[model samples]
Target: MTRFLARRTAMLVATMLVASFAIYGALYVSPGSPLSALTGNRPLPPEAKAQLEARYHLNEPFLVRYWHWLVSALHGDLGESIPLHENVSTLIGQRVGVTAGLVLLTSVIIVIAGVGLGILGALGKGLVDNGVLLASTVSAALPSFAAAVVLQFVVAVKLGWLPALGTGHGFADSLRHLLLPALALAATSVALVTRVTRAAVREETGREHVQTAVSRGLPWPSVVRRHVLRNAAIPITTVVGITIASLIALSAVVETAFGLNGLGAYLVQAAQNKDVAVVQGISLVLVLAFVLTNMLVDIAYAVLDPRLTLGGRAA
Candidate 1:
């Protein structure tokens, strides 16, 4: 276990490094120089441009800048936000909790709704199963933004059941504001998890072990709980992990739609302003999150099924 964890940690570090480089390179390669965004309509003098470049180390080679940025980032210095003129770390610190809360709540909802529906569908062979499958299919086909808009209109705007914009103050208030956006963000994940779970459990239900349990005169529910769901846990766990990881990216759309000042909203603004520092910082953070989540999922596999070995042949 120790060796496996060490190896996976090394891989995570490498993955994060590669992701950071890709984010930095992609930004540099995109249209419009960072300088252009800074200057806006006003044309800067040659000296002014040179000064700005030197200050931000933009005049240095890409490798040199990236290395410097990486080192600084490792030391918890994410540099300054070009547009906001705030420390990148400080900016993220303020808003990350809100985003984390939103994602956490959404993930809970996904696991409950998706896994519950999937299990119910798997156990029922007729209308219940078909209804769950149909719902999952329709949800899977629906675009996230369209779902967000519809929810925003029907739940927030028309019914006035919840706040349509901005994260409210305090825990209770925040929950009220975050509920709709979290649901919208979780729609696709719920559908994906539901489908994955239902399929996995259904496959397990027909296995010889399940039949043996039934032949032993075990109740259907007992058979399902002890045999079917246990055997299906691996794939279901994988889908749940993927769903949670994707929520970080999806928060961009949901946050924007709801006017939440989270990392996603900050990312969108940074991209629009061509704020390279903020963009790079936030992108790296998200990448690290994604990598960490996957690593946790890998670790979870061994926990979910002890017979399965990590980084070696299964037991």
Candidate 2:
């Protein structure tokens, strides 16, 4: 177990380092100069252009600049934001809290609604099962942006129950502001989870152990709780783990629509302003988050099924 954990930890670090390097390279080669954002349509003098290039190290070779950025990043210095003129790390630290809140709340809602509906629907086929299927299909068809617009209109604009946009003050206020966007962000994921869970549960129910439990005269509830759900959890866990990336993508649209000052919003803003430092820093953080979430899910697999080793050996 110690060896397994150490190996996973090493892989995590290496993966994050590679992801960071790729992000920096991508941003370096991306079209549109920060100078365009700086000077706009105004023509710049040769000296001014040279000064800008020198300041940003644009005059350096790609590999040289990349190495410098990577070294500084390893030392915990993400550098200054070109557009915002603030430390990139500081900006990310401030905004990541908001994105975390949104993701957490949305994840909770998705797990409960999706897993609950899936389990209940799988217990026996009837109207409930059909309804769950229909709902999941419909929800999955709606894009995040469209869902956010509809939610904002219904819950905030028309009903006037919640704030339509902006991050309000305090925890309670922030939750209210996040609800609409989070719901929109969670919709597709909930559908995905529901489908994955339902399929897993249904498959587990038909396994030989489930039949054996029934033949032993075990109660239906016990059979489901001890046999079906336990075995079904593996696939469901995979789906939930993989959904983190989708959630990140949706959060960008949701944040834009709701005007929340989260990491997603900051990324969009940075891209528009061609803020390379902010973009690279935020992208690296997001990739690390994705990697960490999958690592946790791998640990979760062992908890869910002790007989299955995370290192691929059967316990």
Candidate 3:
């Protein structure tokens, strides 16, 4: 376990480094000059331009500037947003909670609805199983943005059940505001989890050991808990982790449609305004989150099935 964790930690550090470099390098490769964002695309005097260039290290090589930025970022200074003129870290800190809340709520919905429906489909007969299949199929075909628009119109605009815009103040209000967006974000993910879970559970039930246990007249629930779900946990866990990680990226569309103030919405605005610092900071944060979630999933693999080592080898 110690060796596995050490290896994973080392890989995490290396992945972060590469992500940071790619994010920062995007500024140089992307259309438009970084100075244009600072100057608002207006012409500047030669002397002023030189001063600005020196201040931002525009005169330095890419590697030198990246090194400087990396060093400062290591100290939690992500530099200032070119458009907003506020600290990048400060902006991200302020908005991150909304996105986190949306993702968390969506994850809960996915796990419960997805896994429950999957179990029902695997165990049920005739109409019940058919209904689960139809629901999952339809959900899998719906995109987050389309779901967002429909929910925003029906649930918020017309029905007036939930607030249509903004991240409401306080915990209770925040959850209420985020609920619709979370549902939209989770639509496809729930379908994915359901399908994977159904497949895994069905496959496990067909195993000779599972059949033997069932034939021995053990309680059905006990048989399922011990023999079916336990063996099916790995694939289900993998899909859930992937779905949750993807929510960070998909949150942008839902946030925009619902007019929520979150990192995803902020990222969109920053990208539009060519705010490279804000974009880089947000990208790095999201990348870190994705890698960390995958790491947790790997750890879960070992926990769920003791026969599997932390190194991912079957013992």
Candidate lDDT scores, in order, read: 0.88, 0.87, 0.89
Worst 10 residues of 1 by lDDT: 306-315
- Candidate 1 C-alpha lDDT tens digits along 236-273: 99989988998998899889988899999889998888
- Model 2, which residues run further than 4 Å from truth? 310-315
Clash-forming residue pairs, model 2: none
Q: Best by lDDT, which number?
A: 3
Which ranges of candidate 3 are over 4 A from the true structure? Answer: 310-315
Backbone clash pairs for candidate 3 read none
Which parts of model 1 are misplaced by more than 4 Å?
Answer: 310-315
Q: Rank the candidates by lDDT, best first.
A: 3, 1, 2
lDDT of 3 by residue, 20-91 (tens): 988888777899877787788899999999998887677999899899899999999999876667999999
Clashing pairs in 1: none
Over 1-315, each residue of candidate 2 has an lDDT whose tens digit, in order, gives 666677779989999878887998888788978788778858899999999899989999988988899899888889888767789999999999889999988988889988988897787578989999999999899888999989988888899999889988999999998898888998889999999999999999999989999999999999999999989989998898888655774688899899999999889889988988999989988888888888888778777876667546522
Better of 1 and 3 by lDDT: 3
